[model samples]
Target: MTRGWPARLSSGEVTLRPLARSDRAAWREVRRRNADWLRPWDATVPPGSDARPSSFGGLVRRLHRLARQGTTFPFAIEVSGQFVGQLTVNNIVRGSAQFASMGYWIDQQHAGRGVVPRAVAMAIDHCFFTAGLHRVEICIRPENTNSLRVVEKLGLHEVGLAPRFLHIDGAWRDHRIYAVTVEECPGGMLARVAAPPETG
Candidate 1:
């Protein structure tokens, strides 16, 4: 298992650190403000499912448990010292298949400006180098142009499409799978995203 967990990763002004109970108010404010903006892309509990809704405290506790088990790494995305969003690496697999899936959301006010992309690059770098993970995957709804753009900017390859991949926005939705292996970004994801574009 990875020794250090609940780690802090940063790239420029964007930082990814463990979400804490103390962040309750700030996290709630961002979620409330972006509720409408995020509705279409947010994951929802399927109707009639046995899963109970989780309160903020419950959610944080669960994330902490997962982190201790080395199965998940949850992060609060902060920009220049302000909480603005979340990035979670979930469903980690070890042994011969060292892989994980990543999911994220940002406050509408912080959308674009390369915040999410920078945060993602930092997280993936940590997963590969620090966590001893191989590949990382991000599944995005086709209609979510904003999320699709992040993977595009980072040059993550589109692996395929998954039908009814997840229950999101009140229904099972298809998602386009985007992934990057450590081999794909040998120098590190942060460096790749930070490098200036080449001109012919």
Candidate 2:
């Protein structure tokens, strides 16, 4: 029922597109393969949690509904045209506070190639330049060096730490909040990554 939302965004070597029901198989395979690798960071319900495990069909439905409400952009990250992982722009806020939170996971195979950073840069750029949003933020567990590097490369300013910020893999986790505003990136986020590393 949601009409005219273009499902694709591409830049450099990565592309981000809306996650669909048709991606179930690809999603499952990647998730299964990365289960052990990603379990520690997986978002899961807390102890004695009554939350039901999400179903693929139900997830797609919810994502579509959220998209219709303009509060989330659930996407699949692809590189060289192969589905690799997921990056979601969630907790979108409008009105006086135009901001959203980002969360992502990439296949272990793709972890070190700058795939996540490229995809993240594209998502934040779209949120600011095209979607008319004012701010974007990414929260990472302090021990998550990989996730930390993504924001570090993008130069997202670390705002502060939130104690017990999000439940992950069955327990509450602390998070380092990193954020950027439209006032900071007048040109674009992707443009910054694409810029040559300054040499002294």
Candidate 3:
């Protein structure tokens, strides 16, 4: 169906678009430099499983195919037109569920500045509205305070702790699940994040 095609999703300074084969050079540069910064939080190959794919193009093609199958939206995040990271909306389940999960990473240089929250807001809005999803969730490791803040800023409710939920950094890591349903953000996810806090 290729419903969304991972189009250019923009919110203030952050922009996200489908990753391309041409992004190799720049993406690799940022990824390599941030290798130390991101490694501890990265997913690792499960023990005894077959070797994972080693090619970036192969990963891109798989994501593109998932988009066509109407199961995922994989995007490369950009700050002011410069590539900085990737945000992928995966594990899409339709039918009565209509749910999806998100995973993202940004260049360490762009750590703060509200980039991740806004980008997440934009993506959630698209999933709930344009893509007809009913729920979206983000799972983060306990020691990942920065990622923890991202979900907090967007006011996603804490679902619970998941023990040994994912394999990360070469070992099984527990995760804290945070989620928001369409009913929780009646004004829309993007608009909710843009709203000012109420004053007494």
Best by lDDT: 1
* lDDT tens digits, residue span 93-181, model 3: 98999999999999999998888888899999888888889999999999999999999889999999999999999999999999999
Off by over 4 Å in 3: none
- Per-residue alpha-carbon lDDT of model 1 for 1-200, expressed as tens digits? 44448698877889999999999999999999888999999888898887743888888999888888989998999999999999999999999999999999998898989999999999999999988899999999999999999999999999999999999989999999999999999999888777898889
> Each candidate's root-mean-square deviation in Å?
1.2, 1.8, 1.2
Arrange candidates by lDDT, highest first: which order?
Answer: 1, 3, 2
| Cα deviation of 69, candidate 2, in Å | 1.2
Q: What is the lDDT of every predicted structure here?
A: 0.92, 0.89, 0.90
Clashing pairs in 3: none
Q: Global CA lDDT of candidate 3, please? A: 0.90
**Per-model TM-score versus the true fold:** 0.96, 0.94, 0.96
Candidate 2, TM-score vs. the true structure?
A: 0.94
Which candidate would rank higher by TM-score, 1 or 2? 1
